[model samples]
Target: MSANKKNFQVPYTGVTKIQVGKKLGTSRLYIQTPSETYKFKFQFIKLEQVESSIRSFLPSSVLIESGQLD
Candidate 1:
């Protein structure tokens, strides 16, 4: 059998907004840039740590928010 692989990368510099929210039993992080929006789902407990780590590398101009997921 043969398999194909792909690598996906997103740079932080173009980040325009970051939003962390909880839905069901998991936490979700949404990252928005000029061209696309990326979504990540993780354990609810790690939300803060993930947010802080992402914030450290991003500029203050980037808007970060926390709220319930729609």
Candidate 2:
């Protein structure tokens, strides 16, 4: 994950979009920024944990929903 961070920085302010999906059997969290979309694979972290962590940083106005990407 550290290696992927070199490509883009997560925004400190501004409304960001979040999505979750499964790719090739790996669960991933997708963060959509103004210019690019960042993907983070979670092998150990549960879906609920990820949602909670992201919610801590974002404002209540930013809706965080949990569902399978299909």
Q: Which one wins on lDDT?
A: 1
lDDT of 1 by residue, 11-48 (tens): 66777778988888687888888998888888746777
Residue 38 shift from truth in candidate 1, angstroms: 0.6
Q: Which 10 consecutive positions of candidate 1 have the poorest summed lDDT?
A: 1-10
Provide the TM-score for each candidate, comma-separated. Answer: 0.66, 0.64
Cα-based lDDT at residue 64, candidate 2: 60
Worst 10 residues of 2 by lDDT: 6-15
Relative to the true structure, candidate 1 reaches a TM of 0.66
CA error at residue 14 for candidate 2, angstroms: 4.6
**Model 2 / residue 40 / CA error / Å:** 0.4
